[model samples]
Target: MEATTTSQPKTISPPISPTFRISGGRRFSNDTSVAYILPSDQDEVKRLKLNHDLWKELMNGLFKSDMHEQLTKGIRVLDVGCGPGWWTLDMAALYPNSQFIGIDMADVFVAQDLPSNVTFEQMNAGTGLEFDDASFDFVFQRFLVMGLSVEQYSSSVTEMKRILKPGGAIEILELINDYSNASPAFARIGSWIHQAMSARGLDSFIADKVSSVLETAGFKNITDVNYDVPIGPWGDESGEMFLSIQKLALPAVKVMVTELTDTTVEEYDKTEEQAYKEALSHQVSTRFRLIYATK
Candidate 1:
C-alpha cells in the first residue's frame, strides 16, 4: 500500500452529463483500448446500475458491515469502479453526514443531481489512483473483476489499502467463475465467458483469490460471503434480475465466444437461442461472492 507519487486527488468535471437507455446489449467499448469486456456506453452503464440494485435487494441492505451503521459527519468513502454512482448515491442518501466519492473509467452515467456529500471522478483503477495515503474511511468495489487484467489485481488491492485510513474497511463484490447446477446450454455460455475473458487478458476466476490478495496487501479481519444467485424466470424477483443481466450481456458474449465454439456467426445463432431457452427454464445458477476486510 505504498504511495509512489505525491499528487493530490484531482476532480475533473465531466464534459457531458450522463444519460442512459436500453439498447441491444453489446459489450466491448469502442471508445477505449482498455482491456474491459463490457462497453462503456449508456445502455451498459444503466444495465450495470440495475445489477447493483438487484444485489442490494438480494443482500437485504447496502452493506453487510456494522461500520455502515456508524457512518457519521466527516466520514470519507471511496467507491472504485462506481458505474453511474448508483451505490454511492444510495449510501449518500442514507448517510447524509458522510462524504462519498465515486471513480470510474468512463462518465457514461454519473448523476448530475447529487447530494452535497456525493461527487464522482473519471479514472482507471489499474493505474494508480490520485489520492494521498490513509484518505478514506471506507473503500468499495463491485463487479470490477472483469475490468482489470490478471496482473493488475495485486496493485489494485494495494491501491485500496493505500487510500484507506487505519482500520478502514474495504468491500469487494464480484461474480465468481463457478456456475453450479447449470443446464447444458447455460454451461456452454459459462464456458464461453471464461474463454472470452482470458482472451482479453482478464481472469474470470479472481473472485475467490481476492481475500488472499487483500491479506498480502496488509488487510486484516477478512471475511468472504458467498451466495448462489439463481438465473432464469424462476426464483422470483432475484431470478428475474439475474436473467436481465444475462440477456444484456448476450450480444458481447456472442462475439467473444463464437470463435471458441468453432462456429460461424450464423451457426452461433442457434446456440444463443437454445441458451436463452435454458436460461428461462430455471436450471442455471451463478455464484456471487463478497469479500470484505480492514486495513
Candidate 2:
C-alpha cells in the first residue's frame, strides 16, 4: 500500500457516442475481439449501477483493498473490465490525488463532467494490459465472470501482477452465477446461464478459483473472503434490493443465453418467471468472493 509515484492525475474526455450492435432487442459491444456477451445499452447501464450500489451497501464501502493511504497521497490506479465506470468514478471522487484509469472493451465510458483525475480507455484485458511492468500502485477488476474465459482470466491475473508495483495491492471481486439452496425453478434458470457460459469458454463458478490464479502469478499476502449474501425478502432490506437486481440481471443476459444455448425464448421467459416466484417463497443465496493481495 506504499506510495510508488507522485505524478499528478490527468483528465481525458470520453467518447460521447460509443458504437454498439443490436441483438435480440438489446445492444451489445461492436468489437468482435472481446468476448463479453452482455448487452451494453442504457438498460444494462441501469443494472450495472444497481449492482454497484448493492455491492457498496453490502461491503459498506467502495472496495476491500487496503490501500487508502497510498491512494490519498497519490498513485496510479487501474480498473480493468470497468463496465460503465461506476466503481472507478466513485473511487476517483474518494481519492482526488490519485489518478484513475478505467479500461473496458466496450465504449461505454461515462462522459459527464468527470473529475480531472479520472479517465477511461477502451481495451480488452483478456489479451493483455496495455501498460509498462510495475506501473500501477493499485489494480482492480470485478464481476468479469462473463467477460473472460479461464485462460483469459489467468492471463489477466498475470498481467495485473506484472503491472503492479512492488508492495502494491491488487483486488478482485467475483461471484458464482448459481445460487446455493436453489429451488427447482431457480435451478433451471441457473442451469441455462451456466451452460451458456460454459459454451462460451467462461466459467460462471470462477469465483472459487481466483485465489489460485493469483498465487500462480506470484502475488503474496493474499486475503480471500467469501460472503454469502441472501437474495430474497426473507433476508431483509438488502435482500429486497438484490432480488430486484436479479430481475434485471436475468433479462439482461436473455439474448445471449438463449442464442448460445439454443433454448427457446419462450422457455427462458417461463423459467425466469418461476425463478422469481421461487426466490420469494424461500431463501436463496449466492457467494461473492473478494480477494486482495500485495505484489
Candidate 3:
C-alpha cells in the first residue's frame, strides 16, 4: 500500500488598515438625532424585514451551492451599517457557532430579543471602531453608500481590515445610482436623486469603485462580483421586493437630499414621488456590486 502525503494549505495574513479615526462631526442635530434615535418608523421597519427576507431568499438561490457549507459554521462576523439587524440575526441563526455584531447609527430597529451570538451597537462607520484589533473572521456591510462619502468609504474599509483576523474575509455590497427602464419617469426621478446625492458630495454610483478602494486600502486577493438588481414595479421575481423597498427608499432619499442640499423639503418630496410613479411603469435596473477581499 502506498501512503500519500497531503500538503497543508498556505495561510496568508489578511490586510490591515492603519490606525486612524475620522470625525463624524455634528452631522446630526439634537432634534434630528432624537427623531432618528427613537424607534424606527413602523412602516420602514416592516419594509426592512421584507427586504431582508427577499435578499436572503435571493442569495440562497443565487449562491445555492456554496450556502450550506461556507456560511453555516463558526464565523465571527461584523456588519457595518446594519440597518434593522436583519442580516445579522439571520446569519447568527444560520451559523450557530458564529458571533455577529451589527453597528449602525440607530439601534431602535434592532430586535429586542436576539440570539446569544448576536449583538448590536450604535456607532458611526466613519470613526474608529471600539473593538480590539484582529477581532472578527468576516466583516460585512451592505447599502452603506448613503451614509458614507468616498473618503469615509476608504477609511471604513481600512478599519474593517484592521479588525479582521488573519485569513479573514471582508464583503461589501452596494447598489449603483442608475435606475431606469420602460418608464422614463422613474428614470427622471432617479436622475434627480443621483444629482442631489452627487451635489452633496456623495457618490450614489460608488459601487463601481469598490475594488479599487479596497486595493488602495491594502486589501489583496480581491474579487468583484456584479449583479443586476431590478427596481420599480416590474413583474420580475425580485420586482415586488424592489418596489416595496423603493417606497421606503424614496422618502429617505428625499430627506437626505433635503438635508444635504439644504433644499426645500417639498421640492424633494415632489421629485421622489414623480420618480416612483415612473418606476412603476418601467423596469429600472440598479447595479449591485459585491467586493469580497481576503486579508
Candidate 4:
C-alpha cells in the first residue's frame, strides 16, 4: 500500500486505565463507558504479548500474500475498534505515506509509541465519530462482534460508508462461532459461548449476515471472502497458533461465563479446557469472512 502524506501530522494521547468485571459466564469483558477492562493493561500485558505473537502467526498462515496490498500509498485509512493497534502499525509501516487513524472505546492497550503517520483515538463505535464526511479512502473493521450488536453493526457500516471517499472500499472481518468440523464437546462449548454472547448483546457468529447488513447500508459491489481458519489446540504450524489462541481465550471465556451465570471461573475454565482438548482431537475450523464493498 502506498502512503499518503498530509500537511498536518496526527497526534494521539495516552489513555487512562479503567476497572473491569465479568457480568455473565462469558469470556469477553463488558466495559462500561466510564471504566473498562482491556486485555492490554500492564497487569495482563503477558496475555496481550502472547496474543499478538499468535495473531501474527495466524495472519501469516492464513494470508500468505501481502494482506495490505489494497491499501495503496497516499490513502487515508481508518481502523475502527483497533486493539493494540497491531494492524494499524503494520499498515503504517507498509505505507508510510498513508495516514492511519485507529478509533476504539478504550485505549488501554494502544502502542506507547506510534509511527508518525498513525494515530489512535478513544471513541465509541456505537456513537459519534470525530471525522468529516467522505474523509477516508478506506475503512477497516475486524472482530467487532464483541463491541457491537447487529443494529450497531449496521449503523457502524453506514457511518463508515459516510466517512469513506466516493468509490472507496470498506472491509469487515469476522469469525463464525459454529464448529462444524470440531468434536461434539467442542461444538457444545462453542454453542454455549455463542448463546451467551447473544444474550450479552454481542453475536459471536455474524459473518454470514454482514453482507446483507452492508448492502442495507447502501454499499455496492459487495463481495464476501470466506476461509476456514482452524481453531483446535493442535494440527501443524497453524495448530500451534490455534493452541495459543485457545490459551488466550480462556480468560475471555471466564469473563463471559462467570458474569452471566452462577458458574465459578475455575469450573468454567476446567470445562473449557476439556472441550478444547477434545476439539484438538479433531480437525476443527473457525470461519473467517471478509466482506469487502465499495461506496
Candidate 5:
C-alpha cells in the first residue's frame, strides 16, 4: 500500500482538562488489569463478536468516515482498544490496499496468519501508544467507556492524536446509556451495573460527552451521530445479539455488581433471569454515540 505523500496541517487544540469525575482508581484482575468487568476469556471474545455484529447492524457500515474510500487510496488505519481484532481483520479483508493495525492490552482472540496488510500489537490504552507521530491516516476506538478512568480517557485521546497524521480522522463509537424503558428486573441489573462501575472509578456514561473531550484534545470539525438500540428478544436481531452478549457478560460480572450493590448472589441471579424474560417483551434500550473528528 502507498502512504500519503504529505501530512495535513495541525490545528491548535484546547487544554486536556477532564470535565467528569469518575470514582476511585480501582483495578480488575484480568489480562488488561483495569478493564475486567467482563474479563478477557473465551466469553469475552464472544462478547466482542456480538458487539461487532450489533454495530454492523446499526451503523450499516464499519465506519462513518470517508476512510473506506481512502482505504482504496492507501490510507493507514489504527484500531485502538481493538478487542479480539474482529474489526481490524474484517476491514483488512475488504480493503487490501490499506494497512490496518489493531492494538489492545492482550491478543486474547487475535487470529494467527492474518492478512498480509494486517498487524496486531499488545499494549495498554492508558500508557503511551507505541508509535511515532504522524503515523496513521485514520484512528478508530470503540466501547472504551467501561474500562478507562476519566483522566485516562482524555489522555488516551491525546495519545491517539499524537500518532495521527496531521489531518487524520479519528472515530470513536461508545454506548452512553444502558437503560431506558425498563422493567423492574432490567432496572435492577442496569442500576447495579451503573453503580458498580461508578464505585470502581469507571464512567459508563462517557459516550455522550466524547465529542467535547475530542475537541479539548485538539480535534477539529467534530460531528456527533447518535444511535438507539432496543434491548430484548422482541426487538429483533439487534436485541437478540445484545441478549447473547449479556448472557456471556452478566455471569462473570455478577460478583462485582452484587458486592457493590449489596445484593445476594441468588437474588441477583433470579433478577437477571427475570430480566432476560422481560427483555423478550421489549422493556429495555440503550444509546450509542459516534464522534468523528480530524486531528
Candidate 6:
C-alpha cells in the first residue's frame, strides 16, 4: 500500500473537532447540527461490526459501485460518515494501491494500526466537507439513514459532487426504513421510528428519493438497485444474521427514540420481543437501496 500522504495539494480539510454528550447511559455525538440518533459507545461498535459483516456477506463484497478495476489500479477515495472505519480499513487492505480517507463527526475510529493507504479524519459530512474541489476519484457513503436529514442529505450530495473529479463515481447505500409485508409488531416499531425521525426533521423513507438528489446534483448514468433481505431463520443464514443485527440495532436506537417520542422503555421492549417473534412467523425483510452515479 502507498504511504498516506498528509500534504497533498489536492486535499484541504479543516481542523477536526469531536464532541459528545451522554444520554441514558449511552454516549452520543451531541452536535445539534445533525439529527444523528445512534449511540457511539463500544456496545454500538459491536452492533456495527455485526451489521458490516452481514452487509459484506449479503452483497458478497465491500461495495456495489462499479469501481473494482479503478480501485485495483489505485485512486483517491473518500468514505463519508465512516463509523468505526471498518469499511475504509477493509477497502484499503483489499486495494493496497488505493488511498482511502474516512471522515466522521466522532473520533470513534476502530483500528489502532491503520494501513498506510488509509487515514481517518474527524469532520461532520452534514455540516460541510472541507476537501478541495475535484479532490477525489470516488466517494462512498452507506447506511446513514439515522444520521442525515433530507435537506442535509441533498446538500451533502452536492458537496460530494463538488469534491469528485470529473467522471468520478459516487455511491450510496441506505435502508428504506420500512419493512416489506410487515406484521403488526414490526409495523408498530416502524411507526415509532417514523415519529422519532420526523420529530428531528428527517425522513425515514429517504432512500426512495436518492435518484432525484443525484440528478439534481447533475450526476449522470445513475443506477439504482434494491435488495430485500429476510429478518429471521425462515429466510436462512442471511435472515438469522439480520435477526441478530436487529436485536442489537433496536436497543441502540431506543435511548434516543424513546426520548424523542412518546414511547416508553417498557413498551419498546415489549414490541421488540413481539417483533422478533413476528420476524420468524411473517418472514419479514428490510429493503436496502444502492444508488451509483458519475459526476
Clashes of each: 0, 0, 4, 26, 1, 0
All candidates: TM-score: 0.86, 0.92, 0.78, 0.80, 0.86, 0.92
lDDT tens digits, residues 75-188, model 3? Answer: 678888876777776666657787889887654435555679988886878666778899887888887776677677788888999998877788887878776353555665
lDDT of 4 at 244: 66
The whole-model lDDT of each prediction reads 0.74, 0.84, 0.65, 0.66, 0.75, 0.85
* Cα lDDT, model 1, residue 179: 74
- Please write out the lDDT profile of model 2 over residues 1-295, one tens digit for every residue: 1112222223333333445677788877666566788887667777877888788878888777888788889999999988778888888878899999999887667876777999888889998999999999999999999998888999999999899999999999998887888888777878888888988899998989999989988999999999888888987988898898898998998988788997899998998898888888878988789999999
**Number of the top candidate by lDDT?**
6
Q: Candidate 5 regions off by >4 Å?
A: 1-36
Model 1, position 134: C-alpha lDDT score: 94
| Predicted candidate 4 versus true structure: per-residue lDDT over 1-295, tens digit per residue | 2322212222233333333332442222345532222243433434444544554565552222233555554788898877666667766777778899988775543555667998878788776567899999888887767567766777788899889888888887786777767677576567667756766667677789999988888889888878776665456776667666666665665665555556666767677778767766788777777788889
Query: Using lDDT as the measure, what is the rank order of every candidate, best first?
Result: 6, 2, 5, 1, 4, 3
| Sequence-dependent TM-score of model 5 | 0.86
lDDT score at residue 104, model 5, on the 0-100 scale: 76
Please provide, for model 5 over 1-295, each residue's C-alpha lDDT reduced to its tens digit, 9 standing for 90 to 100.
2222211222122222232111222223443335535455555666777788678767776888766668877878999989777788778777889999888764463655667998878788876789999999999999887768777888889999999998899999987747778788878887888888887777888887898899888899999998877776767888878888778667757767876778788998899898888888755887789999998
User: In candidate 1, what are the lDDT values of residues 1-295, reduced to their tens digit?
Assistant: 1112211222223343333222234434443335555666655665776687688777777776557555855589999988777788778777888999999877754545556998888788877789999999999998877788877777888988998999999999988866788787667767777887887788887898888888888899999998899887776788888888877666555665664445467655676778778877746788988999888
Runs with alpha carbons beyond 4 Å of true place in candidate 2 = 1-20
